[model samples]
Target chain A: MHSDLVASVRRFNRTVTQRVGALDDEYMARGRPLAQARLLWEIGPDGAEVAAVRARLGLDSGYLSRLLRNLENDGLVTVGPDDQLGGDGRVRVAALTESGRAEWTELDKRSDELAWSILEPLTAQRRQRLTSAMAEVERLLVASMVVIEPCSPNDPRARACLRAYARDVARRFDDGFDPALSTPVRDEQLIPPAGVFLLATLNSEPVGCGAVKLHPGTPAEIKRVWVADTVRGLGVGRRMLGELEEYAAERGWTAIRLDTNRNLTEAIAMYRSAGYREIERYNTEHYAHHWFEKRLRPPRTSGSRGHSDN
Target chain B: MHSDLVASVRRFNRTVTQRVGALDDEYMARGRPLAQARLLWEIGPDGAEVAAVRARLGLDSGYLSRLLRNLENDGLVTVGPDDQLGGDGRVRVAALTESGRAEWTELDKRSDELAWSILEPLTAQRRQRLTSAMAEVERLLVASMVVIEPCSPNDPRARACLRAYARDVARRFDDGFDPALSTPVRDEQLIPPAGVFLLATLNSEPVGCGAVKLHPGTPAEIKRVWVADTVRGLGVGRRMLGELEEYAAERGWTAIRLDTNRNLTEAIAMYRSAGYREIERYNTEHYAHHWFEKRLRPPRTSGSRGHSDN
Candidate 1:
């Protein structure tokens, strides 16, 4: 990273963190901390699974359980039964007390005030700058935080993100997406020594991903490269592609290939813009007519992630 | 509205709602209902005034109060603190509870899940469509919700929005904005019975605004027309201009004139596109070297708050 740009980014982060009070001991509110308030909100009026909450929040399971225990002790949340949360019929489902809901409402008001208040000091000109800056920060953070990892096809969030990507392709492609026509990413194929998939995250939210396979005799195929629209310009897609390429290169694959439809103008633009040369019908895969090939450069001896737009 | 289109929107809403379970009565992760959950998210962790909350949410005061009351009772929030809301100290405050922050986190997770779920069932093309539709809806709804009203020159939000516009214009404009040189919108000009101002909104957030004032000797004067960058290209600037023209015509002003710097390309494009002819300079306004004017048809007998975009 360029030092000046990195410094600017760091400054921006500091400014935003201060403005949003991100580093406050408790993220809740003036009266109550955010952790406790979040628990109350999650408990809701009925109940929620501890593990689900943990997964959703990306909180450590033990930390989440302790939080739940605290809420339960306060009588703001009640521990009860849930079929899905635990294997056995009896599971500790946490539900908010009536008072808990009211507490949440108050916090909701406070939080809005805080967000608006940040917008307050700035003249409309400043507000615009702030909004623009926030937008930029969101994009940059999401783009930078992407991590590509190989996982089984059944991984819930991975499957969810890919499905989302597929739906996106369907809407964009002239003929739409057909899962049947595309080769399904098999669970066995995604394992290390075989292949790997990568997931991108920002602020702990999954925003993008990509995958590459270790073919027995052919070039590794790159598939399912995607970036959430919210973070598109932040270069997540390019990064994902780069990661996939690196993974393939590590496995001795010299070239990577992929296919897309005409309707995907942006993706096509992204790929072409990223030095993916058009190939003449490399794959007869039913859904793929437009194929692209990228010859991977050898892994950097210095082990630094290569910085290239393509 | 087209029935099919309306049906499609409704279906979209229902399907999204059902799939996301945004309004699930019993997800019970938080005490607040779906609406409250959304409101909390909007509010963030800061705080908001009663009136602003009402305006943004488009809710009745009584209902808003009751919601606040519920939250307050549950120790999620407190209202009516100090007058820190605006420079004016009469506004009511709403703050969050300890549990409220926790609940907000839960709501945030749910929202992400919902966003994911909506994109999950579609092909990639469909996902693109959904994103496009969302962008359109955001634009159109914002455009439609804007209100053209007579405002005092010093209204803070209006002023803030205008200042924002000025700063943007200055930066984009070659000469840049010199507050000393720029023609300041005078109070007498914007205050009705002389002219009117319009503010654009989206879900109650003030996105943009414009003003028209009837100068006694000269053709009607257009001043203080500014749109937030967040809402640029949404046709708001055009609508505001048209409405100002109608306001001018209603006041028996034959031609409307405005002055702008040469560097403001978008504004110039808008002026040209809207049929305003550049002619010999009209006024001695310190900042304006190029002045433009447009002739307008007579106004309607009864004012229905409309302008001639045609």
Candidate 2:
């Protein structure tokens, strides 16, 4: 890694942390500290189930319970069994009280004010540029956190991601997509020795998938690459493609190919830019209008087993 | 002021802080905390005066001394009087010992690894996009923190910024620029009630300046508009322009004009994009080529005052 890039990222972290008051024990002068304020905001107006809150914030269950007790003592919230949202009768949910509602409004107002304080001094054009750049940075940062790992094709999460991918293509394609009518590479084929499946996840939620099939004497094939719309611009698709290529190269394969529908313009552009060349159709799949191929180099090996996995 | 834009920035702050481990007491696995590690990095290879570290980090004198003492006790550094760097005989400077150099190298290496960990999972193209976006975000964030304040034309920092501007123009102009030869808006002219001079500063260091000379019956003229090259692409020029216009509007003038040499192509483009129109030459100044003007809007009113000045 280039040292300058590290310095730039560190500088960005320092500047942004200071600007956002992350270093402050008390945030936005709300009387309570940032973690508590954040808890209040997360609980929100309608409130949330104890499990949901714990999972969303990735907090220790005991720590989250303590925070809830603090808020309850403050008369800012009430925690009890909730059946209205259709959870089990014994499951407890936390909700804002009337006073808590007012407090939440105040917290939100102060949060907005804090945000605006960073932008108000800037000219209109600078504010626009800064916000858009921030959006881009946020997208990429989220992308960086997404984990792409080899998984069983039949893993529940992997299958769910494929289902989401299928649903998306069905809605987008003119004739409507049907896996039953398309080329089949079932569980047996996606398992190791035949091929491998890769799952992309964010915060433990599966969001994307891709598969590669090895050919003993012929070029390997790539298929089923997809990314959740929530992470579309984050470059997840390209990352999965690279991972699939690495999977193939590790198995001693030097080439891979894939087919796609013409309506999938962005995917086509991504493949072209990723060094895939347009080639003659090698299959009669009813959906595929364009076929592409790319040759791969040997996978890189490090002298030391550095961190190459999440 | 846009609510969505504010929300975007806040979300970005949350994501980036978490990703960079700013919330962690232990940073990049360094044994010492972030403050001490940062002090080591700031003290750097050549060593630095204690005062420079305090000023650069904005740490209180007592707090800085305490941190230095901690490092001193760890046998990683030595802080003592140094006269070779030209400070007073009793002035203290901090330098790394042999073990401190080894420790600094360890910290540097880990920092690089942490940065690479963010990029290593990304494909090459995605890493490129991320780093470049970070660069853009860093520039805009710095630009956002810059404060523009009304200052006496003869204020030492303001004069220093002006001298730097003159030196820059002299190097760039075909015939070379001379403050003596150009039309001068003397100190008296820039004093309030006649006009105002604004200084642009980042962390208390003046980086740019502009002055407006109010005209009783004619459009006010913007003069000496300049930004340090270090901050050029961060939209500081446009900000300074907007600020000068605001200064004029507060005094009841609504139109502003300025002239520049053709060699300053970027300045010309910025003027055009900022709604300045190319009118006939407004002066016979030695380096003047194109003259531009713009009409200003009424100053925005908010019940709450904003931090537009340092």
Q: Write the per-residue lDDT of candidate 1 for residues B197-232, one digit (tens) a residue.
A: 766664445677778876566678788788887767
- Candidate 2, residue B208: the lDDT equals 90
Model 2 chain A lDDT-worst window of ten: A20-29
Candidate 2's residue-wise lDDT over A80-191, tens digit each? 9986866699779999999888888987777677678778877787788888888888888888899999999899998898888889899888999988889887788888
Residue lDDT tens for model 2, B1-310: 3988999887886687667754333453376777888888778877899998899888999989999999899988999898586659877999998888888787767666677777777766666777788877777778778888999988999989888988989998998887788887778888877788999998788889999988687888988888987777777888889888887766667789999999999999999999999999878888898999998775777433222221
Taking the candidates in order, what DockQ does each have? 0.02, 0.37
Error of 1 at B133 (Å): 27
DockQ of 2: 0.37
Extract clashing residue pairs from model 2.
none
lDDT of each: 0.64, 0.82
Predicted structure 2, TM vs. truth:
0.75
**Ten contiguous residues minimizing lDDT sum, candidate 1 chain B:** B13-22
Score candidate 2 by lDDT: 0.82
Which CAPRI tier for candidate 1?
Answer: incorrect
